[model samples]
Target: MPNIPRNALRSLTLLVIWEMWKERNARVFRQYGRPATEIVDSIKGEALLWIKAGDTALANLLVRE
Candidate 1:
C-alpha cells in the first residue's frame, strides 16, 4: 500500500466489510441484489456520511485536489 493513514484504512476496511455484509443479507433475506457499480457508489456515499459524522481521517483521505 502507498502511505495510507491508519485510521482511514481501518475505517475504509470496516465500511467495505459492512457493506458486503449488508449486500449478503439483502440477497439472502430479501432476494435483492445490486450491481457492483451501485455497491461502489453506495460505499462512496456512505464514506461521505462517515466524514460528515466526524470521521476526520476518512475526510482527509477523500478530500483531495
Candidate 2:
C-alpha cells in the first residue's frame, strides 16, 4: 500500500471518502460532473496536501511511487 504508517493511511482514507461525498453532493445538487482523470487528480492532490501537512519524507516517498 505505499509503505505508510497505519494512521497516515487512515487519514488518507477519510480524506478520500470526504472528498468523494462532497463531489457526489455537488453532482446531485449543482448538476456538476467530473471525469475520472480529474477525480483521481483531485484525490492525489489532496492526499499530497494532507501528507505535506505532516511529514515531508512521506510526501516524497508517495510522489516517487
The best candidate in terms of TM-score: 1
lDDT of each: 0.92, 0.77
Please give the distance, in angstroms, between residue 60's alpha carbon in candidate 1 and its true position after superposition. 0.7
State residue 19's C-alpha deviation in candidate 2, in Å. Answer: 1.5
Runs of candidate 1 exceeding 4 Å displacement: none
Q: Encode model 1's per-residue lDDT on 1-65: one tens digit a residue.
A: 58889998899999999999999999999999999999999999999899999999889988752
Model 2 score (lDDT) = 0.77
Candidate 1 global CA lDDT score? 0.92
